[model samples]
Target: MTDDVTAAPRIVVGVDGSDPSKAALWWAVREAGLIGGVVEAVAVWEYPTAWYGWTPPQAEVFDYEKNARRTLVESIDRAIGPDRPVEIHTRVVQGHPAAVLLDAARGARLLVVGNRGHGGFAQALLGSVGQHCAQHASCPVVIVRGPGEASND
Candidate 1:
């Protein structure tokens, strides 16, 4: 009888240049290594002027997709080591973070995200993106809480 090994499940994690997102990236790498699966680091960045009340003369001025993609790739490369065999992919989309992350989860076995993001209230609210992803992602979601997350008494 021949023994067959099943490939590890694919994992998707969202990153937005925040401390919590960085923590999630680190956690995702470790988990991916343990499971022998690759990690997809996703960053969702839309044209900044669209929702900020600034009408740019040229749409390209606020287009952050390329920069965001590069940031994610570089960050993953640095964190996972240059020679490691871990497979990582980077994607940048123009849309809401939650929607983008949820869509990416369609083919993934697991979705990982930070408990907080760069846009939420500093005191007591979980980031809207994380909250939405946790509630609606197609796969199991893992929310990596940051150091600033408070513990319940």
Candidate 2:
């Protein structure tokens, strides 16, 4: 295991408004506080587009970024409480969740994620986004599994 003293590790956590993810966020915040590092809360959202075979409305439509930002903040507030010593940063990206998280993990000292999310069956068998990060991230990855959620892999 890499010693925590090697660097004041920056923790990246992926939140998708799921109970397990909430637990992950809570864990990340506590771990970041313990390590005296910052937490980057990331949410990946993709707007419906031609690639997905969805037609765009003529008028200006929904603001996915704004909504994602709000969700990230709300999740952090719900998990870490309103006032905490941990520094939290929110980022919303447009792409696949696992890919985006892996890219974000490049500069992060550690990547943290839940064992499962809103994604159901595929994630369960594949070990979710946390497992993907653990396998591919440049930095260390931590998988925070929630209580009562059986390990499928």
Candidate 3:
């Protein structure tokens, strides 16, 4: 929320290619349009920590960053479409989802995230990433619910 005339305000959003994330991206875009700001759609990826005995060689390792980028783009396309009303930036980072989002929201006008993501607890109202960002983001935060997401049930 700077007064600098040259740079448009920035609204950072966390996208994980999940339905909830898609809704969060859509809401971020519309909010940016309302404030004449730009959207930063961020997707974070990290190596799987569950594998202990079987480790893939570097040659056989999966391209997580590339897949993350593709997923982010696909989510954007599905959520906001090709015809964007406001400027949208996509960033793929390698780190914890909540930490990455909190860092990205630095100096931003606002931070947006989904109520839930691809977590093990399917019935949870808020996922860890969203909850962490809500508690730690330097700027204001918005947690958006995906289509047909129920509450008070």
Candidate 4:
């Protein structure tokens, strides 16, 4: 018999502790459960570019990644809840959100993200990261808008 378990689809979802991101994770998990797939939750972070041409202290950089991992873990727990329905994985990376998600989505069955993230211009229909992934991801992309999220368009 073929090892079907090894071929299970992997859905990569970008989560940033936002309500919309949580909604995306919820949707991805539900879809994965239905398709007998796996969910990969990705969280990306980077030092502010304001400190251009200068790197932060090693401890500071390490602390940022440490905190990012912690937040990603908490976000996954809160989004998936106690009763996990599908096998889920978490990834924490340091880079632009769109770039990080795009890289993580390589070989993934699907790429999922929130319609809008914790970025400027909340009134826009799709946040920069979501829009970029939708246009450039190798796999299909799903943009989940949180409840009550209205758009100017």
Candidate 5:
């Protein structure tokens, strides 16, 4: 019989520099190891709406994309450590987090995201991005929950 697992599946995971998101990354790595799949770590960057009215001096300006890329790398290093066997591809996109994750998940075997993000609404059990992807992603979605969090349903 031909080995059906010959093809390596692609798993798209969202990272937002949050603890929960890092947990999701580690979970994705473990899952990829089991399925012999590759992980596409996608990090989205955009200036906060509050920054629309203010522009810093040229030297004081921030590089949002560069910061996002650094965050992604640090999260991966902290989560997966330096010795990992699975293939991981990192991507830094500019757009809404949910929209970016959904777009990246196209043609992917699975989509994984953290239950919450680094936002002010700490009371919110499910972050907007995770909720959106769970409801709208094309492939199977996995929302990794951090400690002390329980699913509503």
Candidate 6:
């Protein structure tokens, strides 16, 4: 971590509005409070590709960002409640989940994420987001698991 007092220590966390992601957010908040760092909650979104060569309306296409931001806020509220003591900054980025999280983790002390997300492969131990961030993030990565989730490693 940077020792510069001018900058607030930051811990970046990737959130996908999933249960494990919410747990990761809460864990990050607690760690931030312990270390005097602020938590950066990042939610990534992109316009869905249309099937059968059909395109959605422009308004509908742009609504994903708004929904992502809403989801991030709700996750934060659910995890830490409205009167959280630690400072939390929320971001909605447009790109792949791992790429967006890596960008956000550039200057962070730690990058945190959930073990799995809303992907179809629910039985997997780790989802692509967690695996990618752990492998490629600039800072150290912490993969938070839910209460009932056990580590296979």
Alpha-carbon local distance difference test for all models: 0.80, 0.82, 0.91, 0.89, 0.90, 0.88
| lDDT, candidate 5, 45-78, per-residue tens | 9875646666445657788999999999999999
Best by TM-score: 3
Candidate 3's displacement at residue 146, Å, is: 0.8
Model 3 TM-score on a 0 to 1 scale? 0.90
- Worst 10-residue lDDT window, candidate 5: 48-57
Task: Put down candidate 2 lDDT per residue, 1-153, tens digits, no spaces.
Answer: 566556577899999877777898899888998978888899999876675678677587788888887888888878878797788888899888999999988878788888878775744633557667878999888888765777657
Q: lDDT tens digits, residues 1-153, model 6?
A: 556767778999988889899999999999999999999999999776688757655743367888999999898988889898899988899988999899999989999999899875889888998999999989999999865887777
TM-score of each: 0.80, 0.79, 0.90, 0.87, 0.87, 0.87
Model 1 over residues 8-82: C-alpha lDDT tens digits? Answer: 668899988776787888888789889888888898887655556785678445437777877777767655567
Least lDDT summed over 10 consecutive residues: which range in candidate 6? 53-62
Tens-place lDDT per residue, model 3, 25-69, is: 999999899989999999999877647845456757688999999
Q: Worst 10-residue stretch by lDDT in candidate 3? A: 50-59
Report the poorest 10 consecutive residues by lDDT, candidate 1.
1-10
- Give me the displacement of residue 153 in model 4, in angstroms: 8.4
Clashing pairs in 3: none
For each candidate, how many residue pairs have backbone atoms clashing (under 3 Å)?
Answer: 0, 0, 0, 0, 0, 0
